[model samples]
Target: MAFLKTIREVGKYFHDIYSGVASLMRGMKVTGSYFTRPGSIVTQRYPENRDTLKMFDNFKGELMLIHDENNLHSCNVCNTCARKCPNGSIEIIYKKVEGADGRSKKILDKYVYHLDTCSFCGLCVPACDELALKFDQKFEHAVFDKRKLTKVLNKPGSSSKTTNE
Candidate 1:
């Protein structure tokens, strides 16, 4: 009876080893197949194919303020984008000036954007009721100086068309 028990233990050990080996082979089968078929690789050749690379329309790259051909923007300086920014990445500097209509209104002086602190969450885009803020597909942001990441969205001499008019 003892001899029979020893034989059963040996058989069970071999069965456990076989189960482990089978599981390992099942996992390696995928890797081996990919290795054998090199053409199945899906990685894109970047930088080399920069000319042909077209980013999707919905791809979020950088925050931008929409400007017309006249260099005027739609931002009303309502502070909606600044308030909606999760990381405090947006800052709006404005001044109240007397318009030709004799009414004091806010004029956008500067729209400071800190790209380093931005999480690219895109909350600021939709938060603007005026549709002023948006994400542009300009993702190649590699730079040596971190200070260069900071941007002023409004161009020089550009003013908000909403109140200026």
Candidate 2:
């Protein structure tokens, strides 16, 4: 009985040692793989690699209004994007204009996007029924003043060409 008890204790000690070595090897295996794989290296030399760096197609950086080839935007100024914005980042100001059909229509005067307070939750893009809102890939939006972050989305003097066409 003494011999059997001694053998069992020695077996448990060896088992614990094996488990510890296995855990260590498993961790080292990941490190070794990363060290061997060139593509696994994700360090980008900033400013130097900026010219060649490519952003993914689905990467959402900032909100922008989509203008057609005719320099016309499709926003009807319904204020749906502003209403859906959780943080009051979207501020739209429009004027009621009488169309040729004698119907009063809301024309977009200014579409202000406050990036300083924006959460970028991406709800405003899908909330727009006219597909007017989209995400632009340009991410360099740092500004010295918080008020400068407030941008008007539309190009000046650009009108709704499709509507008038």
lDDT by residue for model 2 over 13-124, one digit each (tens)?
A: 9999999999999999988898899887857655546677688887688899998777799888788899999899999988888888998877888889998888879999
Residues 106-152 of candidate 1: C-alpha lDDT, one tens digit per residue: 88989999999999998998899999888888878789999998999
lDDT of all the models against the reference? 0.89, 0.85
- The C-alpha stretches of model 1 lying farther than 4 A from their native spots are 42-48, 140-142
Question: Where does the lowest 10-residue lDDT sum fall in candidate 1?
Answer: 42-51
Clash totals for all candidate models: 0, 0
In the order shown, the candidates' Cα RMSDs to the true structure are: 3.0, 4.0
Instruction: For candidate 1, report its TM-score.
Output: 0.76
